[model samples]
Target: MEKFFHFVSQTGFSNIEVSSLVMLVIGLFLLYLGIAKKYEPLLLVPIGFGILLVNFPLSPLMVQPENGQPGGLLYYLYMGIELGIYPPLIFMGVGALTDFSPLISNPKTLLLGAAAQIGIFGTFLSMLMLGFTDLEAASIGIIGGADGPTAIYLSSQMAPHLLGAVSVAAYSYMALVPIIQPPIMRLLTTKDERRIVMEELRETTRRERILFPVIGILVTGLFLPESLPLLGMLMLGNLFRECGVVDRLSKAAQNELNNIVVIFLGLTVGAKCTASHFLTFETILILVFGLVAFAIGTATGVLMGKVMCKATGGKVNPLIGAAGVSAVPMSARVCQAVGQKENPSNFLLMFAMGPNVGGVIGSAIAAGIFLAVL
Candidate 1:
């Protein structure tokens, strides 16, 4: 009986054990959000599972080997993340999947995308005031751009310790865009402004389609050398799609390679969510600031859209301006859904895509600027 009691005491109820269980519940909640709510499920599900795996009592998935060398799954995943390989690879997939015709048809929306990045700078200042060092604060601030890969890339370069927090914050807020953005958007714009209609997008020529990636590459390479890895990979993927000679490669990059990398990236990001690192006051602060950053970006984009609406004689739907945060089609879809709520005949999807894609590029540019200045 004494031996049994000793065994129970030895095997049960400790802080790491309790924290691990708590973290497992958190992981399950994240999984529920992904599976049931479909909140960024592709990445979030894997991330949630990884969190569970790493936090399981005595789990070996993320721990160093007995030989005092690191050879775990998370260790390997961290290799790509640490060297900044995953984000560029992900960018390739994004570029291959993106259609740039909307931006080509309505070039003015690029300005709205640019305006949305004000949140990045704004959040950076706020973070600095909150006591983070310049580089760390800058990394946290870029989460406001609502671009996960860009946030990961910049955090990997500038403040690696903060990577997990910043990436999770960026993605979480992105998933919450439907919740966080609509209220700010509604508060800022009137009912009539929400009902504003824009002209349909004109068809872009094949020549323009072919020229865009090439020009984008050259201009980005010349002006922002720091963005080469991201912009270069993105343009390469775009060229593969537009060049008309590499359908197989483009498809593989978009589908297969993207899937594999996402799994690895998601798990690796979750591994960083170990309780000791993630369940901190700073983590809460990071999440709060990330939401703030996203809200500011959304507001700034809509305000810019309102300005353009007046200038364009109400041809621009200010709601589309809120799509300027770079979650690709997700932000654009939110804009469309909200616009349709105002008027059934409203069609803002294509117009929203301009700023949507531009937001992607704009976030990458903001990441580059953070890398350059800080």
Candidate 2:
């Protein structure tokens, strides 16, 4: 009986707390959203599983080493995040997979991308007014960029304590791009604006494609050396894709390297959401502030599209402006979907990609500014 009691006491049921239980449910909810709803599954699946693994009562998964005891597996993998390694590598993979032709074809849309970043600065001020320290606000502010890796990297730098909330908020908003952006795109634009069809992108020459990344790195590196870690990797990846000489390297960056880093990044980020860390009043505030930041970014992107539409004599589809968030192809697709709903002939995907990639670069620059100034 004594042995039986001791054995039972070692189980999770015996050690559970209210906070752990709450975290467990939250983890399960994330899982459902990933697996069933098919939303950002590659990211959410690992992250959700990590949350479940770490939240178990008396779990050793995230425990630090003590005495002769070895630390948990995730404790070491999490160093990638702590040391600021994974996000930049993720950026490299992003570059490897991304084509810069759209952005290069429509350099003017770069302004739309820059315009969207106002949300980050706007949110920064709001968080400060709400009593967050400058660093905490900075961490939360990047969530407006809707770039998960950038948000994670910046949070790890500025306020490591807020990483989980900031990451979850950023990725969740990224996934919600389709849902949140369409209404704003419609509300801000006229039916004619939504129906505006863009000119087909001119064919980018092989030399131009190759030179784009090279020039991109030089310009951005000169302007914001602090951003090189992220942007440098991104440009390197894009160079691999465009150079056409390193197919093997490009494939590796796009697939193997990206997949592995995402798994580690997602899982480790989720592990950071231990009940005590994630359930605080501050976490709640971060989520709320993060949402507002995203909304502002989407709004500003659309508004900028309108401005450009006016400037370009209706050549620009105002909806493409909404793609200025760094959610990548997702935001671009949402713009296409919203625009086509009004006019089936409208094909905004290629056009939206211009601002989409620009948002990626713009967000990285914003992070650099924060890192440099702060």
Q: Per-residue lDDT of 1-374 in model 2, one digit per residue for the tens? A: 99999999999999999999999999999999999998889998898999999999988999999998999999999999999999999999999999889888779999999999999999999999989999999999999999999999999999999999999889888878888888888888999889888889998888998999899899988989989999999999999999999999999999999999999999999999999899999998998989899999999999999999999898999898888987987999999899889999878898999999999999999999999999
Q: Model 1 residue 176 lDDT?
A: 87
Off by over 4 Å in 2: none
Best candidate according to TM-score: 2
- Cα-based lDDT at residue 180, candidate 1: 88
lDDT of each: 0.88, 0.93
Q: How many residue pairs clash in each candidate?
A: 0, 0
lDDT of 1: 0.88
Question: What residue pairs are clashing in model 2?
Answer: none
Q: Could you give candidate 1's per-residue lDDT for residues 1-374 as a string of tens digits?
A: 99887766655253257778878888898899899999999888988888888886666677766777767878777789999999999999999999989999899999889888889999999989989999999898899889999999998889888888888888888888888888988998999999988887999998899899999999998999899899889888988898889999999999999999999999888888888878888889898988888899999999999999999998998998898988877899999889999999998888999999889899999888878877
Clashing pairs in 1: none
TM-score each candidate: 0.95, 0.99
